[model samples]
Target chain A: MTARPKLVLENVSMTFQSDGKPFTALAPVDLEIPAGKFISLIGPSGCGKSTIFNIVAGLQPPSTGRVLIDGEDATGLIGRVGYMLQKDLLLPWRNVLDNVALGMEIRGVSMKEARARAMPLLERYGLGGFEYRYPGSLSGGMRQRAALLRTLLVDQDVVLLDEPFGALDAQTKSRMQEWLLQLFNDFGRTVVFVTHDVEEAVFLSDEIYVMASRPGRVIEKLPVDLPRPRDRAIVSTPRFVAMKKYCLDLLHMAEPADDLAA
Target chain B: MATKTTSLPPTRSLFTVLSLFGASDDKGRPIRKLPVRTLWSNWIIALVQLSILVTIVAGWELGATFGLIDKFFWSQPSAIFKTGVIFFTEGDAFTDIAFTFRSTLFGFFLGTTSGALLGMSFWWSRNYARIVQPYVICLESMPKLALAPLIIMVFGMGLASKVAIATALTLVVSTLTAWSGVQAVDRDQEKLFYSLGASRFQVFSKLIIPACIPWIISILRVNIGLALTGAIVGEFVSSQHGLGRTIIYAGQTYEIALVWVAVFVLSALSMVMYAAVAWLETVLRKGINQ
Candidate 1:
């Protein structure tokens, strides 16, 4: 309880003018993620979940709030936290090794040195032979792995992943979820994941932030309180089912107020 | 049995189409593609294409011999062929062909290089792109061929004017095509680069440049023909020697066979250049896609 939070968002709100009409996209929200813990933001569409990510990633400024990284008021400042989107975004012209080394390369690491640094990660993560192959030749699952490796290699203490596995098929998604939990345990980085899948949020997250839409804000922050190093078999367990059910119910209950407003 | 037979295509024909599109196995996995580019298959297509050419030439010859076609206006194939032999063997065809070839190649190299660089530089500043893009569009819409006469006047009826005209025709198109490619870069990819603390120059050089390379290479195929047309147009306006000059000279003298011979040689030369660029595109594609 006394540990310093790795990332903090205080009263973050976002508004925009859509067609000259003032639109409130995110209501004032507060969040604190502890160091080395996995946090997940799960919500319906238009829930400002990604807006928070953009804020945390330092891509956009919140209209009314501040973000703190390692207790610094790092608001709207870029490169504080590593960021990954839903797409694997590997540069098609570069091979896997070079793609994984992209963030470092951009920071002025010599290509030879970057490749040297990236080779071990590729081998450790089971991509040894594929370091020279291009992204076009890799399978969908492999591409995402390479993307995740790229984000990991950014070496930021806090990593933001926005629906990284949303595009994968069911079997691949489940497999990747388990594999991701392993990587998370190994790296021990603070991860804030955004996703629409309730099972996924429950399986990987230590605490889940369930957001509400219309006037988007974090309504409930529920801690999973499950055991660490969880397995895929837990998805079928009664406790996991109940947590998933509670999330669905919370999501459903947030919908009626929109009906009233409409 | 009747329904199945009606629903399914004949096995061999379906197999061929499926092979072209990439056939999947019974378990929905893509199969190792049968080599679609075997020489034997291409040879069959080549054979059919050759037959079409042969049929056209044979019909033209027969029509000219029977006096069904005007030999004076549309020179007979044999006469054109004979003229082509003489032109290549003994006339100044070498000089003219080389002149046109040099202008086309220089214009192609210069236009694509300059235009692609201009297009790429647009990625550096939003204000620059916004201010400059409208002018690019206006230039693209302008019929540069109409300016060939003025170009000839200014450039003084030499290879310089022809090269200038060719460059004008190709430059704007490469800029526009490459600019569109720059614009079409995946937004998410750009965001990824930004999140990595990429400087504006880093984003331009690292992400924007290589990512748009396929788009830039694709324009090479289009610009080659435009360059050729520009060269020909410049020659028509005024030039010392070129295929374009040969055609215009033959037309004025009413030597129909020489005109046809020059036309045929120009078409053959253009085809060769087109094929070379196409092969480059494929090689680059393979390298990028590896």
Candidate 2:
């Protein structure tokens, strides 16, 4: 916790034009995420939470400025970060085991080794018996678990999750949130997750960065002081409730004043 | 997963094959039982149909004895049966049937392979699609029968000309449908693979083409029929052998029975080809819906 930042974003800015005028999406923002910290970017729709992840993931080049990962420039840092999308994106034709081993497959890992490495992960996530079942047959929660396992199997230094459980049912989402927190604590992978859900960010993240619309800038950063190895009951705890309130206030500020003040 | 099925079940499954074929009756229910009005009250429709067919032949023979219709123009069923017997006995009719069957099968294979490959090529390259798609559609809309003479002129009155005509007729439709199938692949799935660091070639093979299998099978079924038509029409226009040639010869000699026999054999050939494609469609699509 006393070390330098693992990822540094210096004066990162992105501008998208609509109707022939330059509309700024992300303002020149500077931030630092310490290594092994679980960070969540929470914002209202169109606040560019996804843009931030995309920028960091190197899927999109920043309009200006640079992203540094592990002291290297972002351009040369691909495959160092594993990205999981909102959709499970599991290849439907492949079985559960293969889906979990996909990133390793892409990295030129041998089939035997990939399957062997994925075995413990699949078993740990309660998908051991379902190794041969296709993704189409798995429940949404199970698929997301497999997707997370896939990202983990890649052995990337940083993990970027973009609303990984946004498509799940409310009950399943709560269970998955707890599962993710437990998994993060056990593995201690540095996570930069993007979610619009204030509660989810509060419940799972070690630090929450709230973003605002119009200029997609970090308006507030709240340190989640909730205890580690969090459970379902943590959602109703006083600390979690206070953090959610802080996020709500930041989100209110992020919204255009005219839409909320009235 | 490899649980063996009893032969009895497979045999019973064929009884309901029409329902599996997606055919429904007027009441929107599957016609699992024989319909009353089809003139076949028997268990096996093909068998009952065959029996009724033979009774019609008997009636026609009796009618011919009583001079119901002119025998030369509308030949009796018995005479048709006799012509079949004669063809099998003294003539080279079996060879003609075999020739037609050979060419039809060859044409079907050529049409399917080239069509699939060309269609996949179009799918792989946008420029190819843009360049060849218009020409393909144009050629598809043209009557393939009209191309028979031109094909004969180009390749001579050989099996090559017949196969070429068949390929030209079937390939365009298959290519278009296959291209559509490839294009219709889910973008979400593609993005998933792309994010996983799959190259374009891997995505094309692992995601796009596998997703297009059912669509390709549908196109294959339709093209098989077209391929047969193209082959026979090509033969009718030029070749000295084949069932098509036999039909033309019979027509010239006013041998209506021989013409009917040739037509029946060709129809059966088309049905067998179609049935094989349909079976393949079942096998290919079985795991997809899951």
Candidate 3:
């Protein structure tokens, strides 16, 4: 987990033409993410966390910024980057195994080989024997797991997850966070996760970037110093509560004063 | 609704047992060994419906036989049935039916294929959509029957004119359906395909096609009926042979029974085509969902 910065966004900015008017979604920003680290970007709605993630994934061009990968200019790294959107976005017609193998299929891997690689991950990730089921049959949590496996099956080093559990039930969301932290620790993959939930940012990420609304820019970066192999009980710890408070205060989100973050 | 409730209690047991045995009730009844009383009641209900139909037919036959109504103006069912017998046995009506069937089917094929291809092409390129969309609108809005005489004059009063008319009707419907189907696909689905590293062509081929198939199949089922109408209309306007021409010929000779026979044949053909398309749609949906 101590590798050099795998992805660096230098002075990245985004502007969109909405109804013939220029709307700046993200102001100029600079960030560097090291390899094998889990980073969360938390912000209000319409904040540019998604815009920034999209730019990094090569899905959209930054108005002004240079994205570098491994100290080299990454002007063309579209296929090399893996992304999971807020929506599960699973193809309803496709079975779980095929959905996960879609990335390989596009990369020209034969069907047999793609399935062989995707099936094991499905089984290992608590989706065993459910490979043949369609997306419509899976619950929200199961679907999100299938989606993560899809992103992982692409075998890309840098993964962008945009509120992957935003649509889950509260209990399921907590379980998923612990599960993801364990998986991240095992795989040692660099991840940039975006979420509106402050406690989730503190629970799953090593560093949390709190963003402000309207022309979204990163205002604060808080580091979580928790030990590895985090579990659900970590939320009850004093440090976890303190870190979540700091993030909530930074975002200025109004809420009932509760120690649930603890 | 009240009838449905009263009927349910008696048949419930029979249905449960028959369902396990893999039997389907079409006339709303299946053989049940233990539910003999329920089975007899089911037959009673069927008999009542059958009696209603028989009474109506009997009254119609009696009126024509007794000259209570002018049989020369509107023939009886028996007269129509007699004409149908001649049609099947003498081979005279078969030739006419075959003529109309061939022309209409050809037109249907031409219209649907061209329409679907054009619709897909338009969807793929906005520039093409912009350019050709107005022309399509004008063509679709135009009264197509007015063009039939000119079509006959140009293509000659042969099978081609009938085919052209049918094609004209079918093509518009197909194009519109295909375009709307393509547009109705979920945006998230498209993004899903793209994130999988699918190229533009692959996205269109895999995601777009599969999502729109149900819509396309529904359009096809509708087009089958439209194709038959188009063919009949074409035959009525200008054709030397076919069911439409036979109707015209019978009307001129005051042979009302023959005209009624042609009408029934046309309707029966449409019904058959509709059934076939419905069966195909079911099979296709099963395969896609699976």
Task: Evaluate all candidate structures by whole-model CA lDDT and list the values in order.
Answer: 0.90, 0.81, 0.83
Work out candidate 1's RMSD over C-alphas.
7.9
What digit string (tens of lDDT, one per residue) describes model 3 on residues B1-290? Answer: 56554443577677667778866566546655565443457889899999999998899899999998789897898988988798779846878889888887888788888888777667577888999989988988998877888888888888988888889888988888788888887776676666656788988777777777776777877777777777787788778889998888889999898898998898888788788878988998877777
- Screening candidate 1 with a backbone cut-off below 3 angstroms (N, C-alpha, C), the clashing residue pairs are none
- Ten residues in sequence with the least summed lDDT for candidate 2 chain B: B8-17
Chain B TM-scores of the candidates: 0.81, 0.79, 0.79
Choose the strongest candidate by DockQ.
1
The DockQ-based CAPRI class assigned to model 1 is medium
Q: For candidate 3, what is the DockQ-based docking class? A: acceptable
* TM-score for chain A as predicted in candidate 1: 0.96
lDDT of 3 by residue, A110-140 (tens): 9899999988888888899899999898999
Residue B180 miss distance in model 2 (angstroms): 1.5
**The best candidate in terms of TM-score:** 3
Worst 10 residues of 3 chain A by lDDT: A253-262
Q: How should the candidates be ordered by lDDT, best one leading?
A: 1, 3, 2
